[model samples]
Target: MTGTLEIRGLGRNFGGLKALEDISVTLAPGEILGVIGPNGAGKTTLFNTISGVFRPSAGTVSLDGRIISRMRPDQIARLGVGRTFQSTTVFPETTVRETLERARSFLTAHSPMAWLGSFGQRAAGHSVDRVLKRIGLDGMADSEAISLAYGFQKILGIGMALVQRPRLLLMDEPAAGLNSSEKIEVTNLIRGIRDEYGIGILLVEHDMKMVMGLCDRVQVISYGRHVAIGTPEEVRTNSDVIDAYLGKDHELA
Candidate 1:
């Protein structure tokens, strides 16, 4: 089944600080939804909440019509959800293939005795090969993950999530540290994931060009509130969105 994510009235409170409140949004299968706001706008909190890294003080997160808000992170991950951090965090000392194989263990886990008896999982190994190919690192499987160029390292982060074959991918600033051309590569990679695999994507990005060009719709937040949502053009002209990004002193031009 195509994975659809629904967040309803999501709220998170750290003591008196409300990082997110009453934030609601839905991601349909194969849709790329961009979430953008200034720093501290709670974009990371939202992603964390959805990924089960943090439990919401209120509201619920659902995937494929099942409640996942209360599930453990590994449980949520096993339920066809994947996440890439804002930073390109990978196994610095591990080869690309080994990294993926280890990540794949999250989904294809076995008893330790069984693992000892059969060290190789043919299917999981094949899956890692497919992910390496998809992320354009098939030839570099034996290279240390950290040895790749920075952009390729970011791509490896995507591969780490993709190795699980998730139906929904939560990507936090996939283009954060890339040059213009590298940004284009990430844009294409995101679009290709949606088009080719039909994975729903929830993207948090500060790069307006990538978000505007890649997302089917955009959601804007301010001070933990979901302020605006619509097509990129619609959000581009929205006054609240303008204020959120540019401040009230300036107007959208």
Candidate 2:
């Protein structure tokens, strides 16, 4: 069942550098929340903390009221949280089926061969097929994931996360490095995830159009702190947000 992801007063430090300080947001089940900010705004740090890649220096992260700040990444994933990174690289010669199989296998405590002995293996196979079809990759299941086009490779990353059947999905830049058509495809897919599967989504993306149009609510952060949180319209017009994130060109110096 879907549950809330609560990050209260979340803080992270790199020795003396504060990456995130007092960052907070409550992502209710089935809601899509956007975390957008300019360069060096701690967006990645917050995601790393929530996904258990980094432990918070202070505050708490909870799912269904259970504290999860100190949990391992694999452990957190099994608790109905799945994440896709900013980039994806499939193993050479590995088919799409194999890629997803590995991701799903991570949630189970059994070896893949051992898992096949259980009655659940049939169900697992079905899940793999279902995900491939859902992501529009069914026809290419036997094809190498590395052989797919760049857009499909990115979508495959999302499918890898989906086979886990997560209640909440952490997506990093879902629309990054895509052509216009691919961008539209990803936008629809993200919406379908929320409306069809009822999964809460937390995404960090630089694509303002996609984020502003798709998210139920938007959260803006800067310099390790949350600057604003509100509906799309509210966030678009917020002076602080415009000045802090949207107004600034984050190109490398």
Candidate 3:
């Protein structure tokens, strides 16, 4: 599979308000694309429209050339599009292992007889183990999700998404609440996810350092309209992008 996600002339409206207008971008396998804008610029609205939280008022979204603009969220996920929200979403009472097991359930055979069979249990367990190790949570598999440090919780969120084995990951804000050290750790993890797992990532982040350092390309928006699209340096230097989003004093490097 090419694992490409393409959005064409996408737009969304809320009653009389145009939340997003004619936004378009393509994410290739293993590439990281950053989306940024000031508050109320419709970044989240765009994500919602693409991810099935809200159907678009115009245009289409496709995965590997299959039109998926009308598919439901679960249908979208089953097609290998995984996502992490802006807020933490781990089950606080569940162990790290259990959390992953729940995510693995979506891919496992769901027939009662299959679930009752030993083979199914072993398959799920194996998948969970692999994800735990990949996300650096193997040592904490038995720990309650809520008991982990905040940084670990965020990693767990990514693990939950990883268990789905997605070709494309939509990360809302991976570094939103992290300290400097935690942000660095998450940044490295994001790179590792792309380089090692070969998954395309669409990151919506406010951390300019992380965005500039990691994204292969960036699409900037303002008032729900596309303002800039280019390499990180290109967007950073664009006067319109600086004026609409990045302040005059902001540095790309």
Candidate 4:
């Protein structure tokens, strides 16, 4: 279900200040687009704008050419866009299976308590089992959410989103706070999602190594503006990107 995503003339303002400015980018079906910027460079703001947390001051966002920029977050989510927050979003008290099943229930026809009512435990167990297998969490299905490692918890967030079978996933720092091995696990997981489920990804991350290693293309932002957009090699060699990250590391470029 992955399809193209287009952002045109996207801008967001906070009273006197502009958080994002005329940002435009496109992500093709089944492709991973990396977004990188220094702090306060409007990276997360752009994610918020696309994800509908903030209505853009101007412009349009489209998935498969369908406008969704100003839609409600839930509405956007239902239309095949799923997102994982920067911080862990799971409820610590819930079991791994319960977490994803609850998200699926809310996203579709069922309610959280519906599992307890008409469907009974049998149906609920099936639903939870399906999502756990989908995200490689089947082994931890019975584990408490609070008991899992932070990395798995992050994957569980993704599992919750996957239960909705979203077409485009906006991941905020998917590798943040992870050790090298965990980061590798996340990178592979992202690729597996794209390869197996046909989901396109828009990754907002600070791990330049991960971004450069995993992305099909990249967009760089500095001061609320896109300074470069291209292949990993092209962006890595760009003078502006070198200046933004490298400073005198431009010598390496």
Candidate 5:
């Protein structure tokens, strides 16, 4: 079944600081939803709450109609949710193929003994090869992850997530630190992940060009509260969104 993620009346607090307040959003199957806000708008906090890194102070998170707000991070991941950090997360010393194999191993077997078995080893290898091809890193399979260019390293992060065959992907600034050409490649890859693999995407990005071009719907937040939610064009012209986050000079055109 195509996966659906739903967050309802979610809130989070750090001591007296309310990081997120009554934030709610839904990601339907095969949809690409963008979340954007100025710094301290609670974007990362919201992601943490939904991804099970932090439990919400209030409200519930559900995946495919099952409650997941209280689940552990690994539990949520196993339930078809995958995520990438804003900062790069990769094993610098590991080869591309080895990294993907490790990710695949998580799905096939948890114990070292199980992974050492011939059947599990063969299965993980096959999955790793497929992920390498999917992320355009097949040629670099044997190369150390740290040896790749920055953009390719970011792509490898995506590949790591893909090896899990997730139903939903939460990307925190996939285009961050990327050059123009690299950003274009990432945009295409994100679209392909949604259209070809049927995975729903929830993207958090500061790059208006990518957000406006790639997202089907945009959600804007300010001071831990949702200010606007609509299509890219609608959000661009929205007075609340402009006043809260996007300035007048930030053209969506």
Candidate 6:
């Protein structure tokens, strides 16, 4: 079944500092939701809470109607949640195929032994082929990951996630370091994943053009508070959103 993802009253603290406080949001099947805010506005903290990298000091996280807040990172991942980091996390020494092959171990099994057997690599080979085709990297399967262009490496990150066949993908700035044209290409590929693969996407981006063009809904946070949530047209005109991004130039709206 296509799953539902929900975050309710999620909170996180770093001793004296509260990184995220009382945050809540939901994502439906095949929806692309964008989260945007200024630096230290708690964007990544929210993602960390959802991905089980940090347990909330309070509140719950659910997927497909099941409470998963207490699950470990791997457990949460196995439940069909995939996440990409703000910085690329590829193995610089491995080939493109090998990188995906490593991801397959987690995607295909629930036990560590399953990852140790010969079948892991065999199954990984098949999964890698499928993801390569999906991400348009089939021809470069044997190329060293360190040797690919920066944009292609980013695409490889997406391809690695695709190999897992996750129901929900948490993407943090997929277009962070690309040129204008490259950003457009990445945007189209992300849209394809939602439309063609039926995966729900939670996109955290600073690029307004990409967010405005690609997201079905945009959620804006300021000072760790959700200041606005609406369609691109609606948020574009929101005063709080304006002040956060454009300050006095907000009158341009």
Cα error, candidate 3, residue 93 (Å): 3.1
Per-residue lDDT tens digits for candidate 3, residues 1-253, read 6779999999999999998999989999999999999989998898888889999999999999999999988888878889974445446688989988886775555434464778878767887898898888999999888788988988988988888778899999899889989999899999999998898999999899999999999999999999999999999889999889898666556
lDDT of each: 0.86, 0.87, 0.88, 0.83, 0.87, 0.84
Task: Tell me model 2's lDDT, rounded to 2 decimals.
Answer: 0.87
Which candidate, 2 or 4, would have the higher TM-score against the true structure?
2
Q: Compose the digit string of candidate 4's lDDT tens values, residues 36-138.
A: 8889999999999998999999999998888999799888888888887455645768888777777776666543445466565566567567767766889
Per-model TM-score, in order, reads 0.91, 0.93, 0.93, 0.89, 0.93, 0.90
* Deviating ranges (above 4 Å) for candidate 6: 85-89, 109-123, 246-253
| lDDT over C-alpha atoms for residue 27 of model 3 | 95
lDDT of 1: 0.86
For model 6, the run of ten residues with the poorest summed lDDT = 244-253
> Candidate 2 or 6, higher TM-score?
2
Cα distance off (Å), candidate 5, residue 216: 0.8
lDDT of 5: 0.87
lDDT of 3 at 241: 92
Off by over 4 Å in 1: 85-89, 110-120, 247-253
lDDT of 6 by residue, 1-253 (tens): 4668998888888897887788788999899999988889889888888999999998899998899899998889888899864445457689988888776665566665575777666666777787888788889989898898988889988987888768899999999999988898899999988988888899999888889899999988866777889998998888878888646543321
